[model samples]
Target: MKKRSHISILSAVLVASVALTGCAGGNSSAGGNNASGGSSTPPAQTQPSTSGSSGGTAAPANGGVIKIATQTPLSGNQSSLGDAIKTGAEYALNKRKEEFKALGFDIQLFPQDDQADPKIGVSNAEMLISDPDVYGVVGHLNSGVAIPSSVKYEEGKLVMVSPANTAVKLTEEGKKTVHRICARDDAQGPKAAMYAKNTLGVKTAFIIHDKTAYGQGLGDQVKMQFEKDGVQLLGYEGITQGEKDYSAVLNQVTAKNPDIIFFGGLYPEGGILIKQAREKGYKGYFMGGDGLDSSDMIKIAGPAVEGVVFTSVAGDVTQTEEGKKWADEYKKTTNKPLETYSVYGYDSMNVILNGVLEAIKANGGNKPTREQVLDSVHKTKDFQGQFTKVTFDDKGDNTNADVFIYKYDKEQSNFVGKAQ
Candidate 1:
């Protein structure tokens, strides 16, 4: 990787770097007007990054600077999960900074706030792509954002390792730069349907989606599978995001009086819907996908959030001894609640850093190009991380991807084991 050294270019890089401060260290620097992101992206390396990590003084950088970015919703209603993803990626980078330093490189994190919007995500992708120091990116909780943002990443030859994009269309596009550690909606939706029909013994259902790529796509999958299982489908409808009142949709759903209500959206709306549904006197089972995995739902819906079941690509880390230790340290370090995608974010970044490390080794202990890192990441096999065992298939989907079921009770999203 060649870095620009011209005086003007270096000055511009420094100014833009100052303007674009990604979230790290509980806010060491201020961020911009909107979304989780940095400003203009430059290919050149600047003075030592001010990520505000607690690590010691960074080692000398003889091999230029290498940056790994995280693109997630960091400053919105969904920031609960999105910030965790950023923090997890930051933690992974801090742990391996010394290793990269030993290899004559200084590592830094560039987290972007997608704001759960495709247009903003695409704009952030362009900024990330313009920067030459960035090689690998880990992020994108929403599959809609990931799909379009990935097109930009491919244009720049930047490899993106996503922690929580579950839509099937993401990897089916034949783009070499996009990859995700989580399972797809095709798997997640059907698994959720099976659980609803077989385990919960539900025969009739009503579906409500948030009218986005992730929510609608997952809802369609569940509807298809539910029909196959001979379950009665009372209603399948869409709802707008960012709206407080859902009385119109609630009236339609309550009229159906189905055995279960399935929502294919995030926690903010999921909480409001179920909270209002209960108040509307619709006493039926409630289920959803991973978008409801955040603890914020409990806060949003209060007692109404209990008994909610969701399927997630991430599993409970505290079930293992090492995972428990990591979770404890994470809480103590960041003072943030441990969301499910946090471990996935950590694992995804490690996977990217592993690829960067290999690219360096292959480059004879020097900086490697983004193409080299992309190729290295595509060849990952049986690489274990904090949570999942990852192995990317030819299409960039993880072969070891598995879905886990969770139940919310007593103000916790308790792991109900893997979805079989």
Candidate 2:
């Protein structure tokens, strides 16, 4: 991929302003003439007397730290997705360490492995909240894991910004501390359904879910949309995840001879289901949601993954110049290419870090409380980043994000094309 640089003068100005204005006390204000029409003197400004300073002379405050935790599956079938998110977030933090330090604090990342299980996710959430320095989170890749874990964060008044969780209820109930950079399943499901009917020209479709909260919820949304579109629904079934043999269910689905098969589950089971479906002589098109996005899907299903399609809440960031530069740098640093949710991870981390910076500025370089950071995040509007312009809605979801459809190319062993 080609790499290019796009400079942001606004970011440079913001950083300079924060560093220069850090030493000013909270009560400092611009002076104005009094009612007597006499000259009013401005308050004396304190500046960091560091060598890096362009002007002013006061030492910046020290001894404060902000720790952000990542709760995601680092081991197991879904490790690819989790690892991608971790890499993206860590990259963002490392890239902005100096800028954050100049604001009188150090940024630290504490990643916990959720193993894509709700129980484990809750345990990880507890561990994260136990640390007083931990004020923000950047994970819980699976909606099933995120839903249960967010309750813990909400109780602690800690903010969590999700990069991949898309269940509607995660944002629907108005959880103040919960926010996501990705579009909801409610948005993605209808888009996928419409593509299946109008774009793929599929007359009948069968829906299957892994029975997890993420899977079942997405499948139900897709089913609802498909029904509303007046397409023939062959069947809607739920299967237990981590089961090796899906031949029994495949046989039942094959009997219907549906024009399309949509699986609402992670790559592990989705790959296995696709492999088994092809093995059973089912030749119809296979479709899925973001859960089927990882390279592991192709590795699991091999040649059987040809012509499969899926919906992702994120577009191909590498298509843009700034995104390409980021992707190239990410590959050089981690020796791994960016995955579907990596940009979401980068954007989510940026949102959190920006909020922290804003909170610190609001407090006149003083260490901000967790509640202050959460409030800053809630008030974000038109915050531009590499992926998109982020503005949180009343429900804490990104108001401007969109969904994209991608198809797997068997010849290249990768997904290509961004269809909106």
Best by lDDT: 1
**Cα lDDT for residue 218, model 1?**
89
**The candidate that achieves the highest TM-score relative to the unseen native structure:** 1
lDDT (Cα, tens digit) per residue for candidate 1, span 1-420: 011122223334333433353311110000000112222232232233345353655654766777788877776688888888888887777766654554456788877777777777888889888999888888888887788888999999999998898888899999999898889999999999999999999999999998887888889999999999999999999988878899998999899899999999988899999999999999999999999988899999989998999999888889988889989987777677788888888889888877775565555445678999999899988777878778999999999999999999966989999998
Q: Residue 6 in model 2: shift from native, Å?
A: 13
Off by over 4 Å in 2: 1-61, 411-420
lDDT of 2: 0.74
Candidate 1 similarity to native, TM-score: 0.88
**Candidate 2, residues 311-390: lDDT per residue as tens digits?**
88877877778678878887887676678777777778878877876676576556678899999888878776677677
Candidates in order, TM-scores: namely 0.88, 0.86
Number of clashing residue pairs, candidate 1: 4
Q: Give the lowest summed-lDDT range of ten residues in model 2.
A: 28-37
- Give the Å shift of residue 216 in candidate 2: 0.9
